[model samples]
Target: MTSPAPTLLRPDGSNLRVLVVDDEQMLTDLLSMALRMEGWDVKTAGSGFEALQTAREFAPDAMVLDIMMPDLDGMAVLQRLRQSGDDVPVLFLTAKDAVTDRVAGLTAGGDDYVTKPFSLEEVVARLRGLMRRAGTAHAAGAEPILRVADLSLNEDSHEVERAGTEIELTATEFELLRYLMRNQRRVVSKAQILDRVWNYDFGGRSSVVELYISYLRKKIDAGHEPLIHTVRGVGYMIKAPQ
Candidate 1:
């Protein structure tokens, strides 16, 4: 019997680069191996300072960073990068699985988080989700623009605007809004959103989906007619104001 084919997350065949930052050399090597199997250019850093240097030099498309690194924890590294105006999508790896820890990471501009002792498959799935949301993995010229009334999303440019006013959105928010706008007028179930936007069904919390929807509403629906609507006991839908 033949071994299963390696998963290709990036449909566009672009040369995607990923940086894996962890103090554990073994973990970095393992992650590098798994990521390379997907045909990504994978780089590893064993320290926060080294990770910063690599991020600046390598300019990875996405990053998997450990939160407990010595000298400069992942949050500090991310803070420094953000201070320097780098908005690269980041996924935090932490041994702490508490809600506070997850929320802190997210609040600190992480695109996603994975707990320690995670399956390689789950990590890959999360990375895929981040890449997809960051608009780094999809083919260009395919549905370049999605619109619902005054709300518009330019997939190629990763831009969102409402009523001609530019709206800044994080990668995850862009992906969530894109999904909603693509399904305009239809109430998408929370499960479907989790599967499509997050690339996971198991252990997928609906609360996260709700939080993102609220974020979208603030940006896209605030001071407007409210394009995104919640259907009681169902999910969400984007519809034009009647």
Candidate 2:
């Protein structure tokens, strides 16, 4: 699938700010460039102490945090941030490549995580998700609001609400739901979904689509009349319960 032009998410007429925290200069440089290409304001920190200082000064909408550092690990930095009342969305970068490391980050209040040697696309996609879910940023080129039945999504604010209740979604889940909402009741095949949401065919990874749809159903259709329906072999559709 061809990639769309990058969309900037400017909050309050200013570019959304993000901080990349990692000890490696080369990695930070590369990550910062990718984020800047997205038209976001980017900053980098080389250590946990620097991250804390930059977090206070930059007040980023979200963070690309690393789990390992010399003096203070990302976990400690996150703890201090929370203790200082900072609730910024955090996406952790882990070099350990272990479940314990991933779980530790999440259990310590990290919002999302990606292992080392990850693609720039994955990191950018994740940061976009985090910012959108936090309502700290928004899309610029599309109709800001999309709706089907009582479910409404704001592309600009990254808000999704069903009926009168606001729902919280992770970045991937949010993007998947956005695609379904944009298509409304039209049936979308798994291949179409994979391309649209992840920006690549990803080796025709349709099972991931099925997985995310189920996730959306649990949140979007559980207590309410189902808005997401599996069309058997045809893929999926989101429609009103009437």
Candidate 3:
């Protein structure tokens, strides 16, 4: 049999949080999408200052940093982070291909570096290596599964099951379920669901949250003792029926 896929997660058994810092919005969006597809929590910053601020608040396990920016380049950002004793693993993305630039980045505490016009697959693979090497993240074996009562979710394969039967989910639905499953038994607000499941540019509209929750309920809760619960004036949670 083919070996099962692997999942990279924080040592605490949670999704790995990653920071993607770049002056280019397009680049940041691309990287953010690639990382999130790996089931990682990703935050993007358009400048070094924003990156530092997000780092403080997000405490990401790894950072994909750009070396060139009009405001506070990656080297300066890394210096500042090191000064603050952040020690977060950084992967430098730059157009600079000079040997000296690579050495300088590594000397400045970057854990890895990739040239511009790079492959997303390669970037993801490199980040996997960097995060694992930094000891802040690790692969959760051949088959990484999340279980709650009779429902099971596979982070690696994007497969979900309920009571031993396979269930299908759209990309958005899968992410919603993953977020709910990740924080099983804990209420998560619609705002949280909107931010985490969809792209961050949802404009604070949460009606989609209710629509998707209904979609999930029809699939995940129909004909079974409800596992997903709603808290009036609050949000939603998934738990085992006692």
The C-alpha TM-scores of every prediction are 0.72, 0.76, 0.57
Clashes of 2: 0
Top candidate when judged by TM-score against the true structure = 2
Q: Where is model 3 poorest over a 10-residue stretch in terms of lDDT?
A: 194-203
When 2 and 3 are scored with lDDT, the better candidate is 2
Q: lDDT, candidate 3, residue 39?
A: 97
TM-score ranking, high to low: 2, 1, 3
Error of 3 at 182 (Å): 29
On residues 1-242, what C-alpha lDDT tens digit does candidate 3 reach at each position?
97633788876789999999998898889888988999999999999999999999999999999999889999999999999999898889999987788889988888777888899987887787666545566567534588889999876567799999999987568778877997999999998886555423245678899999999999999999999999989999999989
Tens digit per residue, CA lDDT, model 1, 164-205? 999999877998998898899999999999988876543656
- For model 2, the superposed segments whose C-alpha errors exceed 4 Å read 149-151, 157-177, 186-226, 233-235, 240-242
The candidate with the higher lDDT, 1 or 2, is 1
lDDT of 2 by residue, 25-120 (tens): 999999999999888899999999999999999999999999889988999999999999999999999777777777788899888878889999
Candidate topping lDDT: 1
